[model samples]
Target chain A: MFDYLQYVRQENFPHIWCAGCGDGIVLKALIRTMDKLGLSQDETVMVSGIGCSSRTPGYVDINTLHTTHGRAIAFATGVKIANPDLNVIVVTGDGDATAIGGNHFIHAARRNIDLTVLLYNNYIYGMTGGQCSPTTPRGANASTAQHGNLEPAFNISGLAIAAGASFVARGDAYHVKKLETLIGKALQKKGFSLVEVVSPCPTAFGRRNKMASPVKMMEQLRDTVVSVEKWEKMTGEERKGRFRTGILRDIEKPEFTAEYAKLIEKMRPEE
Target chain B: MSNDRPGKVRMMQGNQACAEGAIAAGCRFFAGYPITPSSEIAENLSVMLPRLGGKFIQMEDEMAAMGAIIGAALTGQKSLTATSGPGFSLKQETKGYASMAEVPCVIVNVMRGGPSTGMPTLPAQMDVQQARWGAHGDRGVIALTAKSAQETYEQTIRAFNLAERYMTPVILLIDEITGHTTEKVIIPDASDIEIVHRKKPDKDPENYLPYRFTDDCIPTLAPFGTGYRYNVTGLCHNETGFPTNDSNEIQCLIERLTRKIEIYEDDIIRNNELMLEDAEIGVFAYGSVARTAQAAVRICREEGIKAGLLEPTVLWPFPTKAVLAMAQKVRAIVVPELNLGQMAREVSLASQCSVPVHKLGRVDGSPIPPQQLVEKIREVV
Candidate 1:
């Protein structure tokens, strides 16, 4: 078993998450992955916007910044550009990343800046007590959407891929083992890499959808997720309640900081 | 005093001077969006920052630009961003974060006419109040204004200096006219300029407190990626840099944030008083309006009217001491602004109604002409 205690701020324990929240599982997977990758705590920065997942930065013993709602990527962009040697990771959630922060989300991907974005898609705004989010499934019940959510869910990984992110993948809270593997790959990727984890919100999302039990939510995830390769073989009708997981898109490109370093060298005046 | 120092002299626009000034202040990171009257600062830095081994990034928007600079500042880089009215409004939330987090950065607002995109190409001092109270919280704000390209160059450096010294966001407010106007600026020699960097923590990493209080109230900030691993948040945090709900701790955090700047108010305020030695009437103005007010004061002196000018380069922390002293001597004060009586209200409060404070304002997207100020000064005298 990985000793996650080494990475966590022990004094901040009795953590803020409600009982059986998938965000904690995701957090465990992240630390385990970080440990496996041998990332230096002094050289790594974790930035987050406001949300339940944003609390992750406060718990981690690292150079962390808890920024305003939806501006974590923008802040992370500066950290990476200011010193490309530092490993910068952004921890954000569905509403924080896609609603108020959608512009920054797309632009950071477009810049292809060196940032690892761990987007926890809990399908609802859990911190604000289950408000309808950009990724809230259509017809799902939420505090704001008492009757049902009117908007279609966003394809988060597809959005990253379309916005020119060099690496994009999907993982789930139920699939914790594979999630670590996916995160490890993302941490090693050269450009803007995104791992959109379909983490479930048991209290806010599950209670309204009649899956109030955290076990039921995990079971639902287990039944629905297919590997990316297997997903391609399924017909459109067969993908009704299911989603794909694994490295959905990966490519090579000129990363923003590296290109900037080259520009600095080329523009330097002769001594 | 070092204006006559042997160095490069060039005629440049106020916005260009600001970019060069930022470089002189050891600003190695610039994150900005293209906003009217302020875009030239970004354009010039785009070419200059790279050559000088600095970093320049044209962010997605004004809010991101503000956020990026704050992030760069945390990583031990002197960072800056420039914007106008609407963009400044967008940046308020992030600017407030910079305030609460105690990040040292500079924001340059080249003022343009607005309540919202009112006029992009013209100059106005409408953001005077916004720069101080634009963010939601109660914070000690440092905002500086300039009258010409030469002053803009000098004040830009001072803006960075104050930011580092106090570990707070400093606003450099120049009107569109000042930003667009071209003038000769003498770039002081490298050895002639004094630069200030944020104090780095020398304490043991095992007991590092990012927001520890001191007698001076200013806290040393360790840059990220240097052995010190700490958390920074917009939420009210304890000395340990972690959020705390304890009321006493919250009270201390808020008070310290304000006190750090207030205790040093005398050192932060900068104003120029001209020919006020034996004058009975005073003209109070800033930015481009002050340039015209100086001319109007000269006109008043020539016409046998005892008139003087009080030009405050630092707008916030209000310059109350100087205004109070001037109020005691002058019979009446005339405040001519590009906006409708923003600073005039401050002048009234600062003067404590000892004498009547008169306002001469124009929001027609143009500067207050010297003749208008002359007429106003004549009426007041």
Candidate 2:
């Protein structure tokens, strides 16, 4: 077993995630990835917005900033630009990153700033007691959507790709090792990178749907996710309910901070 | 960047002077969205910051601009953002976070007539009350005002200094007239000015407590990438910088937010009272309107109306002591501002209604002329 305990704040545990919540699985994967990369605790900063997933930073023993609702990406952008040497990771949720924070989400990707975004898509506002979120599927029951959600769910990976992120990937809690590999690849990417983890929020999201049991939700995620190659080969009708769970987009781009540093050097007066 | 050019005189706009002042005050990061009457500050910094290896980012929106600066400030970078009335309203929530988290950053609000973008290109002092109570909180805020391009430059530096000294967001409020006004500014030598930096922790990383109480009630901050790794949150946190639901801990955190600045009120509050030693009438004014009020007082004095002027550069914590002192020296107080009567109400309340406070306001997108202030003063007499 990996010594993930060495990277966490022992006093803050036992963790806040409920029994069978997939957030813990994702947290463990993040820790394991950090350990694998040998990231220095002192030089890494974890920023989060308001959500159950945003609470991830509080348990980590690193420079963490728990900011206002839906502003984590904006804050993380500043941290990255201010000190490009530091590794910046933004931990946010579906509602936080897509609903109230939609503008910042697309803009940060557009800037292609070097920020690793671990956006936990639980499909509902878990912290706010199961309100309908941007990722809440149509016909899904939520506290706010008691009559079934009328809005269409957002394609989290597609949105990042369209917004010009250098790397975009989708992973789920059921596939823990694969999720760890995706996160490690994102951390290594040069520009804006996003790993949308489809973690289960059983307490808030699952109890309303037919998958009230955490095991059932985990099984549903396992059954629905297909590899990118498998997804591409599927017919349009066959792909209706299934989603791809691998690197969706990857390319090279000039990162914002490096370009800014170059601009400074060029503009600096000669000694 | 060596400040070898001492007393170098230049004709500059208030917004440009504000940008120069930020550079002089060691502000290395600026994040702002363009809004009229304040965009010059952003434009000037974009051209200047790169030359000095400082960072300037035009954020996507007003709230992002505010959030970015707070984020930069946390990493031990002196940060600033400029906006107008509508943008200022958008920044309130994040501004409150800066207050609660005690992140040191400067926000410059160049006043424009507004209830919501009322007049983008025109001057109005309507946001005076918003500067003090815009955010939902009980924390103490430091807000300052300037009446001229030269004063705006000096006060911009003061805003940064105060933000650093107390580790709180300092708002510098100027109006469209002052922001666009052109005046001569003498750039001071770097050695001639005092620069205050945020106090960094000297203890070992293991024992570092981000919000531990000190003798002055101000906490020393460690840069994010440094050895000291701590958490900062908007929640009512304990000294260890983690959320606490304990009643005593919550109360202490809430009280300390205000107490830290209130205890140093003497060092923070600044005002200028002229010819009020024996005058029977006094005019209380600030920002661009103060210039007209000063002229009005001089005219009234020449006309033998016994009028004086009280101009406050620091607007919040309400300058109670100075208002009370001025009330004793005058029978009536005249306040002429671009808004209807924001600061006049503060003067009236601070004076305990000892003197009848008159308000001379104009929000028709034009500044109150000196003659109009003189008329208000004469009417009060």
Say which candidate scores most in DockQ: 1
What's the lDDT for all of these models? 0.93, 0.92
**Model 1 clashing residue pairs (backbone):** none
Error at B283, model 2, angstroms: 0.6
Candidate 2: interface RMSD equals 0.5
Sliding window of 10 residues with minimal summed lDDT for model 2 chain B: B1-10
C-alpha lDDT (0 to 100) for residue B194 of candidate 2: 86
Q: Hey, what RMSD does candidate 1 come out at?
A: 1.0
- iRMSD, per candidate, in listed order: 0.5, 0.5
lDDT of 1 at A260: 96
Interface RMSD of 1: 0.5
Clashing pairs in 2: none
lDDT of 2 by residue, B1-381 (tens): 122446888999999999999999999999999999899999999999999899999999999999999999989999999999999999999999999999999999999998996999999999989999999979999999998888888898999999999999999999999899998888887888889998879799888898998888998889998889899999999988999889999999899999988988889998887788888998898988888878888899899999988889899877899999999878999888888899889999999989899888888999889998888777778
